[model samples]
Target: MEKFPQMGGELHKIFGSPESPFKTVSDNILQYTCGKRAECIELRRKLLEPKDAHLAKLLTGIPPSSTALFEERLLAEFVRAHPSTVRPKPRNPPRLPPPASVQPFPSTQPRRERDPALQVQEHKGSWHYCFPIQAQGHQEQPLTQQ
Candidate 1:
């Protein structure tokens, strides 16, 4: 006796001829199985805490599961793999005050004295006044005479 195909194949036999519907159902099942298997493999790899190089090598042969259905899973896997804390630092550190090439207009405002209880903040603005600096985007000479 020969072994016969079951499930989808048997269903195909029961439903008139097995040409069109069988093809469609078989394709659908194949796609589903492939996607599920890929997801399982990926999840197992992630849970196992494999090294990056090993994971990268494993990924080379595997085809994308299903462009539409597997996207969320892929994204979740990516997020799980990367983690937000390991993100690169911002290219620009917080902008420091503009260089001494620009100066603020002179005012008779009395300088505030440091209180013993208060924390001393570095006066970034002092650089402009301390040096007779030229205004940025302006060709005008320094406001204070040297």
Candidate 2:
């Protein structure tokens, strides 16, 4: 089989050829040794070539390469620029005054001639009354007859 130069020496030189220690080892070797470290450094250098250092500085406090930082800052600025909401004080219902006019009348009536003869005495917390017979000449007589 014929050996290809691009797939062999040229590509290996550009990506930092493997060290002398890995010279005797097979290319299919999976384990890490001194040669693997050199090749990894070369690859890292190539990958970082397109990065912008100034852009990195501008986004110092933000999460690494994430869009959430811009969105959060924009929302905060919008909230600060807008006017705050005003809430009206709570109002109490109006109180109604008492009625303007009131009429007064007496509850008790005067005793009549034909009314029952009742003798009242206060005993304990209640009033006790005695009823007398309605005689023709005994209308003005005392309730207790000794």
Candidate 3:
């Protein structure tokens, strides 16, 4: 079922990563299941400890202090916790340098504002406009200063 792949996914990821000596999922599983695997035995032993028991309880929505639910909860929770597969992200190719024929612009002039009086400012992630408004038959009213 999905559980097999999910457990395999974490194991497979760790194998490819710096954590495990095995190169593939099948190799890791075969080694663990076949002999008296020290690593596998140690990991299984740790799962019965208080810390892992707490995690199991949290994942299974059982009260943390309840010791009776540890074994069943741990097995169910651990499988459900990890995803079935985690595909590596695709890396972007390096950008090529611009051709020698293309020349860089040497202009150093400051950008000119179309309207000098109408200043715009950002406040608390929102843009505020400081400009005058002219209502019908009313004098030009400057925006209220925030």
Candidate 4:
């Protein structure tokens, strides 16, 4: 049976359509692999001129064009493919500004320390009486007299 050209177009629309590069590539390493969005935009802007026609063709399998849509698509594909080789890393959070006004009083409450008791320790021959670390500003209370 002869395949219809219309069917081919339909297939491309349904299954072969380009997936969103954001989803295609892992979000964890997207920034590191592709750089910030502004940087990608700038790089796409530079790619419009096609300084090397051969390189552009080799990268995207399409001829370079000055059109904005072409540039965006090229960059999207480039970003999607570039990060696959490296494992994804967690995204770095944006730096926030420090508080404008300093508080008059600092925190005065003492922080609670974790339990300093040891579970098990072998000292020479005995296998018991594990010593616990002394907490600050507190005296050791006798649990029981030996």
Candidate 5:
């Protein structure tokens, strides 16, 4: 389930970390020790691979890799060590001059005159204008013949 370092809780963090000591161990049969440290180093190398690193970074927000059993605790530790890089910062979408509003010509009233005088409307591939004439109250709006 919680396979990546950031996916699990404190108690579940049984994986090795990048900072874990990786000195060579004595190979003497009698003095030979476990390979956990070496495994830890290899795990770090794998996680640091550009693809895996990016994968780890992209998961939580977009989700939720690699070897199934490796403790994700190490990945979590990496995130812990470098908070900004691992976690995505919220980005402000470019402020658009609020969309050039296309308010349809009001059927009941005139649009206050602007420099353009008339508002243009695009239909299919052609342009047309709406001139609201208040005759008593309403008048038939015409579309220019194509």
Candidate 6:
């Protein structure tokens, strides 16, 4: 069957004769669909011009023409709803200083006292440390370091 002829018959049947209340819409739709198809492309461009204008506003920050019905509805919805970003802003906290009450760490190892007896005695080939001898009546006592 011939496509457009069948489509017109079907549209006419569905919408009624050409003089019906749906004239403009059905006529524009038929014009957008009819003819050598090249003409149909032009008609389609004209009919959906608002969609293209909305897309232009989306692409560039500027709107090429006055607000279209689609844009009006979308912006109205946005006004009604609380639109937020898909993801929240990133958080970067600052490094904090330590409290004044915190004190410094103590030394890891304790210091030891020196032993004087451990000093080297070179004169005697055998190493020995001598203490003063105390004179007693019959015995001698070694005086130790106080």
* Number of the predicted model whose lDDT against the real structure is largest: 3
Tens-place lDDT digits, model 6, residues 77-123: 54355233123445976757565456344343356666763343434
Candidate 5 lDDT by residue in tens digits, 1-146? 44676666543433344332331222343244335645665566455444455655543322113443335765576567656655454697575443335534464356766745356677666666654554555533446656
On residues 1-146, what C-alpha lDDT tens digit does candidate 1 reach at each position?
14654666666565646466867788799999989887776776454343566555543334444443234565466558757423466998898665555645343345777555323232532312222233434332223333
Mark the regions of model 2 whose C-alpha exceeds 4 Å error after superposition: 1-101, 107-116, 134-146
Give residue 56's lDDT in candidate 2 (0 to 100): 33
Alpha-carbon RMSD to native, per candidate:
17.9, 28.7, 22.8, 17.8, 20.1, 23.8
- For each candidate, what is the lDDT? 0.52, 0.46, 0.53, 0.53, 0.49, 0.48
**How are the candidates ranked when ordered by TM-score, highest leading?**
1, 5, 4, 3, 2, 6
Segments in model 4 whose C-alpha atoms lie over 4 Å from true places: 1-70, 84-101, 104-146
| lDDT per residue as tens, model 2, 39-135 | 6655653443324565334333332213332346644553354323122446985767434443232323355565456676555545555457645
lDDT per residue (tens digit) for residues 34-137 in model 3:
56554554465455434445544544453233234335665556547643322345698687856656645433345765897566676555666655553444
TM-score of 4: 0.19
Better of 1 and 4 by TM-score: 1
Count backbone clashes in candidate 2.
0
Better of 3 and 5 by TM-score: 5
Pitting candidate 3 against candidate 4, the one with the higher lDDT is 3
Model 5's alpha-carbon lDDT is 0.49
Candidate with top TM-score is 1
Please, what are the lDDT tens digits per residue for candidate 4 over residues 80-116? 7654423455699686755546433344335666556
Model 1 — which ten-residue stretch has the worst lDDT?
A: 125-134
Every model's TM-score: 0.24, 0.16, 0.17, 0.19, 0.21, 0.15
lDDT of 3: 0.53
**Over the full model, what C-alpha lDDT does candidate 1 score relative to the true structure?**
0.52
Task: Name the runs in model 5 displaced over 4 angstroms.
Answer: 1-71, 95-146
Error of 5 at 94 (Å): 3.4
The TM-score that candidate 2 achieves is: 0.16
